[model samples]
Target: MNTAHSLAPSQVSNKARVLLPGARLGLLGGGQLGRMTALAARAMGYRIWTLDPQPDCPCAQVADHQLQASFADDAAARELARACDVVAYEFENVDLRLAQTIEQHGYLPQGSHLLAVTQQRLREKHAVAAAGVPVTAFRAVRTRRDLAAALAELGLPCVLKTTRGGYDGKGQWLLRSTADAARVPDAVFHGDAAVEPAGESDTALEAPLVAEAFVPFVAEVSVVVARTAQGDVVSFPPAENVHQDGILRFSIVPARLPQEVLRRAQKAAERVAVALDAVGLLAVEMFVTADGRVWFNELAPRPHNSGHYTQDACSTSQFEQFVRALCGLRLASPRLLSPVVMANILGEHLPAVMRHLPAWPGDAKLHLYGKAEAKPGRKMGHVNVLAPRLEEALELLRTLQVWGPLDLPAPRLSS
Candidate 1:
């Protein structure tokens, strides 16, 4: 028996299940991703329920029922699985053991193993490399001695990241020289911090670390792929990503790269989805070097920020595609309907964004996640600008003063 085949839904004694409209879909997270997914599921005639510590989480605003509990609470996780026909998760940092417990209660199409592999930096890199994808040089750092050895091997300007529980530029420290190493704790490098209640422990949480050699890349791009239990797969057009201080700030769809390069990225993403037997949306991020080499950067096994452009550019958005895949419906076309650029609205931009909201061009669409408070670096929402040509859309995005500036200009779009 092939292990890969066994991992899929077919191996289960129970036959493949299709969740029709009006079924209660359970989500493990209630952030913006869950909110958008819930909205899509509701439009397709499905009732949505979610488990989130915050009763008024973004998803709670749209879901039929909200189980107010921590993600690590096994009892709440089990209750959520029991209440819904099938279970899915928006975020990847969910407790691995809790997900396994939920699996015992009901359907979790994406599976717990995929979650386990993605939640840790070291595991994700190893998994991607095993799939025959190229990745940057990296080493697991578990002690001060290990960090010293890794730095000696990988060199200065390396990035030390927690093995688990970090996102949006958090839980990362850049060591540019020997002086920077002093700031990182010896215990942090060793993953010796005790796990605390509510998943909070130390100033820099105790978790294994991975020190990676930073690559000088010309562009960052991502491919979003949707896969189903039946092995059907479809990929959205690649998106060129721009980041500020490690946080994604903008994404340009139909990334201005050679057709051959785009094809390579797409194919690699499809291979990754198959290797993981991923059952929903999987976003594979890659780096394109100045020499035209593409290297795997990371993975998000759910609707990604880069794919947010699909909401206005494609016939089927990534969020809706996630819903379709979760419900066992046939995957829809991810073909681009128009050239577009999407800008993430950080908390700092909220005031300006609201002031200029009514003045935005008719082709520009703004989506605001209903977060109660706006803090610096928090993803409040986003704006998608559409046009007949990629350059036109990018030009419109560049002109949006509300976003401050397009700091890293796209070489192809820059005049």
Candidate 2:
């Protein structure tokens, strides 16, 4: 592990500087992102402390210490601040008042303001639009009258989402006709069949909502940008993503698109990071049209699932870039080491995936979260398949077919 530089003028009794290695880093959320980030920080000779309600969460399993408490626990929040030199967030669902307490300590570089913007659909879209990035047509809906008006304005085949919370396709409704828009403002209910998916699990059922024009986009892509407080930014390779039921199914590197589309997507993502004046890592999700124009979709200010392939296929992994960016170290080169296809392993599919693991290819890298039990639709782990040719990687992935979207299917072993 490279120290690079040491803490300034070490005190005889006590010394701590978040800028250098050997300092304790407190992670706010303890899912797989925290788990991976902690692993990276530990490899760099830094201590890890995770704060999450789950005592045995994936991140806590690897952390040096764990603060087992809800995000609403102020005492635990302060304890984390006092114990660690710096704090970084692994997720965006931190409580509002608790964020105020943590921000008072000055360790949170990407403050509550960023959270406030991303937590709400309307504000996020406005910020992206203000950054001169193109976004789909949208309108705010408050009452039943407002819902009717928005549907009339944006038309059917639009999406109605809660302004706050709701992630990974939950807490949203796709209205294709007057019937879908019938009950609104007072309450919006959905059948299991009517639910649209999102990237996270924040279903803010009671919060206000926003309506957006449904885009007939050909592909969805994301770029993970790492920026320091000094404005230095490095955007990772744009990944073509596939989502079903509102959850990411897989992320394909060297996206099967024209070179011009890839270049513009990366540039557009960087522009949004600059526009938001973001520090740390920001994953920018965008919709790329057939004509090569890029449209902003959403932002996740943390290590994103879309960039998971970087761990096995990039010169510098997103986790390492995360630590470097937060600690003010020089950014690493975002070069692709090989073509990769990262596929998510959901809970229901874990058994089949494990059964075939013994036959996996030499270059296939598997990462499983330390989750106790597997539930339907829960993200358990992911595998990254790397090959000399991108097509070869895709073919290799196809052979392991427990996971599937429209193009990919379940694989069966030869008898």
Candidate 3:
């Protein structure tokens, strides 16, 4: 593994200069991550500009300027970069080439190499495994023959996922039987769901599918690590995550695990950050088996939903840490000030959430994304409930009763 300490002084010297207060910061995505990052940047006395397809995007509401455009618009990306001192992206799905283009016009502290590796699952898995992190067995499925071979090797109860443009449970399917395997088309396996057809650049679609063996783990956990341009690294405590229908439903901080397990998870996360030469935030998700084995599950090279508890529970929120890292500021301690539980508010829960809005206690901090419309399975907002004890926070979340009947079946937990 290539450690940050092994880099040459010249390589470190070439990094973008430290962006100070009053400088304008450009963000690539105007979703919740960008919105929160903008909020933090504004609080630090920096002007913010954002580019997103939605004119009324959440981040746009707080930004000094909003450039409404598609992620693939190279001209708009350059315009955003030219208008700001340094640029950062809140999501990983932004076009990798667009980021490279932005770098030519202005400083992109986070760099584009990590984004290129993370946008596709096949590449991401390979990167992680190459970094000496243990990952579940997986094979790239570019054709029906590949899928069949992977299935034969990995067996039933495995998962088939699109290599790119998948999040919050989109673009993946479970294969539990031969019938499930027979339903997938060869074209779907090879075509990228995120790429525009015959675009300005003839971007060939990479491997579009991946098949992985399913591990029946006791719990899912994640650690959010932030790295500065100077190679300083800091990470928050591991968060125990629970997902329902492939969407993260809740994150319990100070994950219920042995101290040894937590330490291992943290170390693995830090190693990933250093190996990727990550300059901003990177959230590493892992699975812990009943026997205490940890396996890499996924990687998000930006603010993560699992880290939402930090907004209310930590002295420095993840968004602030992200800004600090990008601007080359000293990283703050990611201490857990209090035990907390964060529950995602999906679109299905909005009605009940609004009806009980005034009933929530001060301990519960509600963050709505300011989206115009609510659809099934859409992440409309989240609520972080803090308490002196983890059990109390969990109880409060359970009794909140905001979430209605889900469209899909209840999430299956490991025995």
Candidate 4:
């Protein structure tokens, strides 16, 4: 049996009615992504019900109803399903059992199949490759011997990552040599990424670690694509991304790449969504190599950090598209309104951002998540600077010096 196959879209959407205004959107997880999506839903006159452990979570702040309960609480999960018309996910780390329960009790348009595959690196990779998208060569390592064998097969300078939950580079380590491999704890092979997850249950210890060949990527880009249950699809322009200390810091729109490469990135993203038979948003991250090939990196089946620019620069925000996809509505145009530079406001940069708030540029749009605490490396908010030209926007960010300069100027955009 093909492990990557998707249930037919017709089966998923046949019973779907156009969720009119006043519909209750059940949001799973309540980070900034949830908050933003909730805001979009409200703009369309839809009420939101958010389930998260934090009573004052960012999403809950805007949602019409807040269910402050643990994600593991089956009772609360059922309650959220029964109380809302459509339930959707905000992040990718949702428990499969929780999603399954929601699907059984509520209308989860995007089923748990993608979650089951994407929960683990091994399965996500298999699904992406099976979809005919190119990905870095990888091997599954469940034991120390598997690690050694995978290293031998892929060679040094690879990446060793836990198959389970980790974001912002938590579960991944760049293995430059055998010494690096030796540094990874044996527990990692057993499903603990050694990155110290908050709880044992947070780790998907049943799955193995994935040892992936490190690609010498020239640039990293992501495309946010949406598909409706009725088979409609649309992709936003690719955003060039830069990561610092394993966390994303910047996403530049109209990625300064060859036109062909940009098109390839969107096509690859659309391919993944079609192959997955996705019914909502899917963010496909890819690497543009020196050879001009765009290789699949990973995926997020919800709104992505890289697509944040769409909130300010596109004709339709990704959050709105996400809402549309969930309700089986016709997708709005994803036309680029301007070249934009989206810089993340890490906790370290929050003070400076606050200091300059009054002086923030007219062309810049600020979005801050209502988190009560701040620490180094935590994503506090983001600023999207728009301009007629990409260079002007990037230069504006440099002048602010809030986070320093763009990692690398897009050669063509600079010219």
Candidate 5:
């Protein structure tokens, strides 16, 4: 399936009534994404429940009911389903069988089928290609021999990735040459490392990986599209993404792309949403080639790391749209209200950087996740700067990241 444009206006508002306001919304996983989603649902008069192993999870702090249990605990799953009207997940690593147990009693928008396909790189890629979207050529690797064979097929400078449970550049390796290709198995798992995750239970050590040809792209962009059970669909403008150390550093609205290429990316995202009958948000990541062709890179079947900018930049954030669509509410008008840029605060130490934030204009929006501890590469919060010109917003953001003082320029805002 290719990312094509076949969105019907009616499909834009097809949520089920079971997830309406006043209903207890059950969310699986409790990270910053869940915290944001819970915050939106609570603001709209919805009661929220979540099951997370961490009792002090950020989402748990705001939810109406928080169950401290593992995703694999059948008792926890049953309790979660019985206590809520609809069930949802904030992340993609959810177990399909466990999710199915919840769906037997409640609702999982996009449902088990979509989750099953999306939780694996191989399946997600195949599904995207089946929908008519162009993707980098990939082959599955089940054994060390399979890795060697795939290398021969896809060639060097390719990506070797776990079919399931890989995200944010984790569970992936780059095979630069034949020597590197020969070392795939050890890089994937060796002796004690292979058995290290036995306690996690949810992570399978034996799952196969997929080797894919790496595309040389000019920029990375993502499209957040929403669909309802009634079949209506709408996609927001593509957001340009930049990564530092494999973690997303910032997301800018109104990606600086050729108009035609932007249209292609948006259309491809719409196609995937419609084909999968995906309800709620689907973030389609794409690679824009030098020749201007937008190739489908990956898909996140939930609110994405990139769309976090929508919270302060657009008329409707992805969180609100997700809640509205899941509750069968009329889709809100998604209009761009400003030219904005979002910079992620990765470590807890960044709060020290806040001393310099005062230099930024008052119009800039900063949001901090209520995380108790700050660790390296941990997403702590984000600062969003808005201006008529994207460059001005970016400059103000750059100032926030500088280590020491300098003669920073004044920020200009348009009337």
Candidate 6:
């Protein structure tokens, strides 16, 4: 197997003015994103070292070396840093302290400050808004009184979120009425969800949260952009995303949007990256309001779930872009290679539908995470198919004749 040190200097030397194929790349998270990164890196002649707590994490199964440890484990992170030339992140919720620990040994593209700030909703909103990008109206809630005040200011039908560790819909609450106040107890008990305070105890974890007046959006869309050390930047095609119960269900590429609106979305993403001096993939999620106005929703500094469709649809996938950026190489052009439809496979329906999944067309691209077990609403894999048009894709999906979602009964466990 190809290893980082076995590559020629052109491939793995960080001190070199330029990076070549076969470099050793270190990844901070070992989920599906890491697995995809390792696949792309290997295709480019690079090797991978991964850090994750799971012994059988999806990415660990394929990495050249896997350091099984918590994100907060400093000694293991140092060992991982020593094994790689440069480091990149997969998910945004990585411990800030862990990031700092790794930064001491090598480099983390997008930087610790970017992750430190963007990890929290209030700070992220403040930074994005300060950068002149539009965001939903929001206020910070520090206590029960603070929550009451933010509600008074932002009003009801708003979103309540902890500042630090929330993602994919976790650590968030929807407040529709006064009765929803009961949910506040969970956040207080959970502590600060978004921003982590320095020199603070984990027990006093509950800090200020953010409440935003939720906008009624027509659809959610995202643009994945990347920046390099040389200041080069590029954006992939916009994707129209659909969500259910706060998790992404489907992402359609070259999203069904007007030309002008598409341009606006790309511009908004580019604006944020430049403002942050961001040096890796930035997934900018936005709300295209019913009125056609585009509002910045949230930002993920690393590869994002919404951009997964790009793996099959784009000439340069986000994973490749990330590899290029973290290695300080010239950025690649982001262009759609085809019109595609991508659907997420959730375990919620997997048990009931596994028997029918094999019936899907052999041509469809099916990717399953090496997760050991399945649970309701858990993401198991995804399917991407290329077709002539969006309508055709949707039609093909319907005609595929799979059973689950609506009509299938709950699966029974075998003895």
lDDT of each candidate versus the true structure: 0.84, 0.79, 0.85, 0.84, 0.76, 0.75
Off by over 4 Å in 5: 1-15, 185-207, 348-351, 358-360, 402-415
Model 5 score (lDDT): 0.76
How many Å off is the CA of 85 in candidate 5? 1.3
Candidate 5 per-residue C-alpha lDDT over 130-202 given as tens digits, one digit per residue, 9 for 90 to 100: 8999999888776687777888888778988877677778777888988877765565533221212222233
The count of backbone overlaps in candidate 1 is 0
TM-score of model 6 relative to the true fold?
0.88
Q: Provide TM-scores for the models.
A: 0.92, 0.88, 0.93, 0.93, 0.88, 0.88
Query: What does candidate 1 score on TM?
Result: 0.92
lDDT of 2 by residue, 1-415 (tens): 0111222232111211237888888899899999999999899988999889987999999999999999888898888887887788888767755666777764766666667667667778888899888999988776667778888998879988877667788777788997878854345422222223223334443237788998777788899988776667788888889888889988998887777777878777777777777778999999877677778888998899999999999999999999987777788888898999999999998998989999987878999998988998999999999999987888888788676533742222122
Q: Which residue pairs show backbone clashes in model 6?
A: 22-45, 162-194, 163-194, 163-195, 164-193, 164-194, 164-195, 165-193, 191-206, 192-205
Quick one: best lDDT, which candidate? 3
Best-first order by lDDT: 3, 4, 1, 2, 5, 6
Candidate 5 at 314: error in angstroms? Answer: 0.8
After superposition, candidate 1 runs with Cα above 4 Å error: 1-15, 190-207, 411-415
Query: What's model 1's overall lDDT?
Result: 0.84
lDDT per residue (tens digit) for residues 257-341 in model 4: 9888898888888888888877789999999888788999898889999999999999999999999989878888898999999
By summed lDDT, which 10 consecutive residues of candidate 1 come out lowest? 194-203
lDDT of 2: 0.79
Number of clashes recorded per candidate: 0, 12, 0, 0, 15, 10
> How far in Å is the alpha carbon of 243 misplaced in model 5?
1.4
Counting only residues 3 or more apart in sequence or on different chains, how many pairs clash (N, Cα, C under 3 Å) in candidate 4? 0
lDDT of 6 at 300: 91
